[model samples]
Target chain A: MRGQKDIFIVADNIVSPLGGTTAENFSRLVAGITGVRRQDRPEMADQPFYAALFGSMDGEDLLTEDAAASHAAGGGFTVFERLLASSVADALHQAPGIHPADDRTILIVCSTKGNTHLLDIDDHTPAERISLPGSAAVVARHFGFTQTPIVVSNACISGLLGMITGMRLLRSGLFDNAVVTGADVITKFILSGFGSFQALSPGHCRPFDRDRDGINLGEGAGTMVLSTRREYRHGLRLRGGAVSNDANHISGPSRTGRELGDAIEVALREAGCGAAGVGFISAHGTATAYNDEMEAKAITLAGLNAAPVNSLKGYYGHTLGAAGLIESIVTLASMREGIVVPSAGFETNGVSAPLNICRSLLRGPLDTCLKTASGFGGCNAAVVLSK
Target chain B: MEYITGSCVIDGEGGYKNEKKIFSFAAGSSQPAGYLPALYQHFNWQYPKFFKMDNLSRLGFAAAELLLEGWETGAYQPQEVAVVLSNANSSLDTDYRYTQTTKDIPSPSVFVYTLPNIVTGEICIRHRFKGENAFFLSTGFDPALLTRYVGYLLEAGIARACITGWVEWLGEGFKAALFLIERKETAGAVPFTAGNMDRIFKISMPCE
Candidate 1:
């Protein structure tokens, strides 16, 4: 790896219906709690065929109680941004000594739909005034970060991409410690958009299942503190990561699965590990037909057919931008806790590949896990994390 | 730091028409109806679907295609290159359409294209690039930040080269520019700095 950055996952946090913090979410996942549910919103009543699964938006009220009170006054951010702020606060609380004004520290925010929900509001002025950077800018100003915070919005792979960006900045000696955050809230825009493409699953998502329908939209945020190897500690180490696009299709996945497989192989090689080294695969199993099939094939092609695989989508639903970071956090938690949570809603063995789909929480002394994700534009990313 | 090897801008005026030409669309000033017809005529792209794309996707794809044409397929692999794009208005055209639809009839098709990063995603799929990609939304063009970001990707070995620029599409018009930047051993190459940016603007701007 480009010389070990002493980066340590000093602190991490997650906010989802599965549970609030990382520990809560991991516990619920181990307990096999499926957060997917039928849409109850009156707005979606007309769309009977489509069921909207989402994380609890209760966290929005919690932000007012937290430190981001002033920024939350205007109420421009969606539930996802509040969740992101909560995760950030949780991380900062855990790492009490780290200061944003230190200059040595940086903030990297990732999301696909950063406050796009603001567009749904009646007040066009507020919506137009508050841009994606405004969310990070508010967080930066709140934390007193004088340096420019880096923001990444690379569709579904945004979470993992943020981590990679943070690693680069930290390794380049641009900052000693960086706060990497990812958040994406559900909105009519995203829901209707995916619906238009017929990518959403009407029933519970069944990743890698033979009858896998499609992904249920979910929203949440994941945040972690990454430092150089000199700052590395006992939590988890981001070994290596790579992103690749199929470029074969705009909306559809590549049939060859060459790019996705190549990305996995490249990440593993960069991490100085082999396919066997990955104890489990945290797949981007959006449960969509094309995504699941493509991911399963890519995993098998990477020679990890025997590796226990699970999609956290059942737990948190397909959290678009936050999935990568959220899943990566879950992978690390699984490694540290010695248990691989089951793919929450899987009931049948599906797909052509014989994947060791974890139906029940599997005990582990798991050392390494591969976190993979793919997006609408044929973008795919794979990141390797180790304890 | 690296120098911006080649650059081109195409707007309503039909600026660049060579084998590899960068296309720029200024919101309000250059309408897609006017420029795209000429663009299609010049590129000889017969696909009627080209006209169907919104301003953001159209300008983004055109500029990216132009930049990609300059690189030899064998010289730079898709996996080795990355796209770092920024836009001020994040899919406002789709946003506007979706908003309008909501008032009358909500169309899912128009809603899906509202996200800004779709352009980068489209560019990635078009070029098959997967290396260290990111889409930033800035207040405007900040050459220092852009240069710093591109430099970060290059120095860290994330990508051998970067296709970086600003792409903002509002209503029927847009403005898009791209730079194919590669790291240089010496300072002699044309560095993409604020000074050079100012010079380029002066050269490209209409004479008063």
Candidate 2:
């Protein structure tokens, strides 16, 4: 509640299989609906797998009618770029004072993989056009952004890390506001990779459940407009944020959970809020055995064991780069409605450390919340959002 | 203000530390292709994990090893040293290789290194660094952004020291220019400025 809580969330949008807007997605979560289902796409994987994907759309068909108008202006916009543009447009439309053309504004794009799917085509895309920076530039130009766009490509934490980067830049007087967007498509590239690691679950993912197997891959996009002005309906503000590394195995979780725990502690300290002030936690519970168990341990180590925790993976099925922002937007929705959404796929206590996993809908006042994510490269990120 | 305590650049030409030529490839050698393993073997470093790394990680790991050599006892705690890196191609080098494997059974080892930040992970694991980690993507090395971001981290007390630079690899080309930044001034240390960074990065690149 103290220090500079000037960075407020002006507006946000989420385009997932569950819905095209945050309100639609949040309502579906509250009603106990899941977007994950088994698919038999021979192109994506040989075996049937569970995932929440934008169905039956390829190339320009994935773009909305409005976004397609801009796409037809010049070079084609890849599916990944289209998602970012569509989501950011909706977020910008909701905000009153934010302008993309203003020099004081900036755009930050986050994605673990952007336009890498072009490799699937026989015609080799030029190296520059296939890069994440190239996609970011295209989106920036489409929006008429006056400043250079910054692209963050960290593993799974890219979305949250992007927001943290945006927040820091604004606080440093580098920009008056920032539009942060993240998206990743479900492609054979990702499927075969995750399939090789045996990380994708066969059915709906169950977070914090004893029988939890693995994650259900998801595809979606999310955007949030953050500004120094409080000209929006939702007064949710990003109070503090921190990033850390486990220094452990590149592809595995930390054995002790101390790394993620450290990030949460530092983020809370920076927010000037005690553990008691946190209303709940929006966890990066991908439902993988190690990830959920490690997160449970980190929560207890951070002294927030009593705060009700939930993961949106069961609904959206772990949307890679978009998970952090989509989940945060849903968390803000929970705060606005004064209700805690249930952890959709949870059945029982699974982790060794005791966590207050919310298994059912709970209506209550929420003031502050913590969102966390961990990814490949042994990286972890945590952010404290307050009302 | 912070100072650049150490720096190491490795590319087709050879390896240089603090603007001094510390290692060079033999004449008529098939360079830029066998450069990373050659450097690793030349140093006689005994880390089996080095072989498992993709070219990007190997390039970064070797450069970092040279950058932090003889500085085992750093002034800051393990969590006080941050790793902030940037590049253009990202892990596309590995992405292309991994895609080849996807034609049959995908290789998990190669699949893991598809993300650009995995290099940071490997470096952190080797050095036990637990501080902030971020990997940015741009058309080229951006000294201004790194100077401003790393400076902010040091000023805000988020990190006491930082490992900032650019490591890029695609096809047959690779470049790793890493610098260690700290608040303390050493004998050969220089002021951490955008101009200095850009100049040092250029020094690391092969002549056109």
Candidate 3:
């Protein structure tokens, strides 16, 4: 909704290989570090693939270690579920008034293939328990949320779409607060599936780079507490957001990128901000040739070519459900710091259309930022964040 | 304010328009996959892409086809109509089939249909609806939630009309309820309310 009531992102947390919290991840990003590394998973393939994975380290995983301590009362959570709970738990900790039991609070879990990895032939967990909605319910119940949570699974744009869904819920005055979180763990199923499409990169992904190959899949959780009640004095507000379909292909992106441009234009208009007001543009640069090219075309068509654009895929390696929020959180951090984070792995301009790819950190007065994400199934979403 | 202008349904036996069965399968067969192509032939609708689609996409596309059988094409802008769909199982049938291929080499064709909303994309591609679209996964149909979100889209100027559906493509038993909703008033437009939806979904099918 183009809402009159102000919806603010009061608290956010990112649980990723970069770190366990937003600050930790942002600081690591500022240091030009990446979570992408080569791992040997025979179950996935005979070869080692490059990805951002947080495995059970040294037989005592951090997620398990913490979950056992925090959730001593009840514990049947998978690793991804633990990641989701920890992310939202941290966000709730920051904003205390918006408790899970609050009548005005709603939970929205945005995940693609939440527990699908658990459906291996040998795994004994009931089929329903591994369902996306059921997994969301288990997490919501574990956290004691009173209302039935909603689950969104529209491919890679799931996170951004869920954020917009939460904004609509708040704008409709049906819920004063919404805890939006999304997480998807990498499995052999996804790795092989992307392998079938030849969309997986074996090396570090270079977004908007001439040498870029494809995506390096990752797994993590990102959560943001959206509310009309201001929990922080200097918080980022959800100005406008929109979702659209390419109507061209089921799996392939639009060749012209016109549909994505339409989404960005509408989001900016609803936010009451012109293209010139966007200090920086956060792009959905998957590092694939077509994805980057289409995104650059969309940005230029939106008349936002001059804005410094960057993709966090270089650092986070495309963390599926967590990519949009983690990148948005880092973009907000960069905006708050007045320095645009460098496009971590850019070497040269790659796309047919020219974009001002940020090769290094730049300092300026940044205000409103535009974030865009495109996914399989021709789903595209854009959200504007204003300070 | 929105109105439900059209509805369609398909079950184990055959297809129906507004709860009236237009056709029935030959005796002693529950194979929807085998029956759907024959049904498509019966209607003489030609779209080569329908054969390439999975059972889910086929079900959704055929339902939309029947719903729009006699609809006025100029009723609403294609880019201003949203497609909101929900289902309990999130592409598990296809996911299981894809897993079978993953043992050797994953079939890109099968892997692509592993996402539930690919059906929505197929429908949008057929009709050119570029508006807001979302695929929600819930325990069951939540008419109230659908009413609230669809209402939000209308009030926010994000969409002028919507095609809301609840399609489940589990092998043995499948259900699809496709509704075309428009905000414009017309002679026979019914108020797009939760009560109306609950009433419509509760229609008794003579043959289960």
**Which residue runs does candidate 2 get wrong by more than 4 Å?**
A1-5, A59-62, A230-234, B204-208
* CAPRI docking class of candidate 1: medium
Point out the higher-scoring one by lDDT: 1 or 2.
2
Best by the DockQ measure: 2
lDDT of 3 by residue, B80-143 (tens): 8899998888888788888888878789999999898898999899888899999999888788
Give the CAPRI class of candidate 3: medium
What is the Cα-based TM-score of model 3? 0.96
lDDT of each: 0.73, 0.89, 0.84
Clashes of 3: 0
Which lDDT tens digits does candidate 3 get at residues A37-57? 898978767789998888642
Summarize candidate 2's per-residue lDDT along A14-107 as a digit string, tens digits.
9888888889888988888888988888887778999998886474545766688987886488888888888888888898689989998999
Q: Chain A TM-scores, all candidates?
A: 0.93, 0.97, 0.95
lDDT at position A222, candidate 2: 94
Q: Which of the two, 1 or 3, has more TM-score?
A: 3
Error of 2 at B71 (Å): 1.5
What is the Cα-based lDDT of residue A208 in candidate 1? Answer: 81
Question: How much native contact recovery, as a fraction, does model 3 achieve?
Answer: 0.78
Cand. 2 Cα-lDDT: 0.89
Put the candidates in DockQ order, highest first.
2, 3, 1
